[model samples]
Target: MRGKAVVVTGGTRGVGAGIAAAFVRAGAEVVVCARRPPEKPVEGAVFAPLDLRDPQAVRGFFEALARVDVLVNNAGGTPYRLLAQSEAERHARVLELNLTAPLTATLAAYDRLRRARGSVVMIGSVSGTRPSPGAAAYGAAKAGLENLARSMAVEWAPDIRVNTLVLGMVRTELSALHYGGEDGVEAVSRTVPAGRLADPVEVGEAAVFLASDAAAYISGASLLVHGGGERPAYLDAATVNKEE
Candidate 1:
């Protein structure tokens, strides 16, 4: 990755920060962008301010970049809201952040990416594959995001590669908030087959691998960063007992 220029959207903290730091360690010129600055920025990485939701701003941001070898669309999140409890506008906003933002950024960076034969790595979620009861909008948007990447890969074939990293629960600085508190986090972690939550750095390494030459032949692939995924709930209620 030496001499390469990598751009990570919303890379100021958490999973995004981890990804940016990984690129820096790989000797790439990493640029971390977000609406706000990092509390403690990654060492050896440059910072750029960006809000992915703004189309014109996104275009301008890309145009200002001298070079781009990789683009990681990692900006997105949605509060836990029941489908019937929230307004239609609120759900729509979730769609815009998780789905439309990536599209806008990709389109804006198309020229530079094509020029450098760069690749794109989208941060997806496992919620898209299952029934996301509380965060339905986020899941729906992620599902759409995965589909978009597949089509983008085909359309931009022989030029730029596109892929997705479908993640499960990651232990970030904000994990406590999302998972209730420490006790809640531990309870949730035990539910996964791996017996623990995923580390942000692990996700970062996976993202790096996908964008590296190691994955040159890979495109439109959905790499699962989940820690063996959650254990099936049905087993607990199964009438038939298994001999251990």
Candidate 2:
């Protein structure tokens, strides 16, 4: 990855920042874009202001930037809310952020990726594989994202690779808000088979591998970084000898 140029969206903070830093650490020229500027520029990283929701803005951002050797479509999240209680517009907004934003960015970056023979690493969610009660729209969008990657891989074959990192529970700076507090985060982590939430660095490492030569032959694959996934609740019930 020494001479490769990588782009990470939503790179101002959280998992996106980690991914950008990882590429920089791996000796790649990393360019990060976000709606707001970072508090500080990552070492050896360039910041590009971008609003990925707007397709024209996304295209302009990519057009002005240098060539891309790798694209990490990592921007996305949803507010926690029950599907029934949410309005259609609200649900659509969630879908837009989690699905359409990446689509816009990917298409914008496609030409450069084709020219460079680059790869795309999409950040997916376990909620897509399982049911998400509080974040239905986010889950649905992620499920769509995975499918979209497969189609892109087929259409852009031999020139580019498209893959997904299906992430499970991850500990980020906003962990406290979503999981209550640090203690709550620990409790949630323990429920996972790995007994811990993934560190952002781990997610970044996986992205690095996907974008590097190590995954050159791998395309349209969904790599599960779920730490063995969630523990089965029925097993605990069985141990207690509970009745139906």
Candidate 3:
């Protein structure tokens, strides 16, 4: 990765920061972007404030870049909002952030990526693969994102590579908001086959591998970074013997 210029959206903290750090370790010149600066610094990386939702700003951000070898579309999230709890506009906002924003960024960076034969790593969620009762919009957007990546891979083939990192419950600074306090987190962890939430660094490492030459020829693929995924609910409620 030496001499490669990498861009990580929403890399100020959490999974984004972890990805940035990994790239830095791999000797890439990493630029981390977000709406605001990181509260804590990611050593060996530069910070660039960006609002991915704004098309004009996104274009300008990419246009100003001299070179781009890789793009990590890691900026996106949603609060817990049941389908009926929020207005359509609210749900639209979630879609804009999770789906539209990445598309905007990719379009803006297309020229540079094509020039460099670069790769794109999309940060996706398990919510997209299953029912998301509380975050329906986010789930829909992520599912769309993976589909979009597949299409992009087909359309932009032989020039750029695009893939998604399908992630599950990850322990970050904001974990408690989704899983509650420590006990809540523990209970949730027990439900996963891996018996624990993933660390941001783990997600980062996977992203790095997908972007690296090791994964060459891999495109339009969804890599699950989840810890063996969630356990089936029916298994625990079955009438079978405890020892099987």
**Best prediction by TM-score:** 3
Candidate 2 segments whose C-alpha is farther than 4 A from its true place: 240-244
Lowest-lDDT window of 10 residues in candidate 1? 235-244
Taking every candidate in turn, the Cα RMSD to the unseen true structure, in Å, is 1.1, 2.1, 1.0
Alpha-carbon deviation at 220 in model 3, angstroms: 0.8
TM-score of each: 0.97, 0.96, 0.98
lDDT of 3 by residue, 82-189 (tens): 888779999999999999999999999999999999999999999999999989999999999999999999999989999999999889998887787998999999
lDDT tens string, model 1, 18-83? 999899888899998899999999999999888888899999999999999999999999999999
List where candidate 1 sits over 4 angstroms from the true fold: 242-244
Measured on C-alpha atoms, candidate 2 has an lDDT of: 0.92
What Cα-based lDDT does every candidate model obtain? 0.94, 0.92, 0.94
**What local lDDT score does residue 205 receive in model 3, on the 0 to 100 scale?**
88
Question: Which has the better TM-score: candidate 1, or candidate 3?
Answer: 3
TM match of model 3 to true structure: 0.98
What's the best-to-worst order under TM-score?
A: 3, 1, 2
Give per-residue lDDT, candidate 2, residue 41: 73
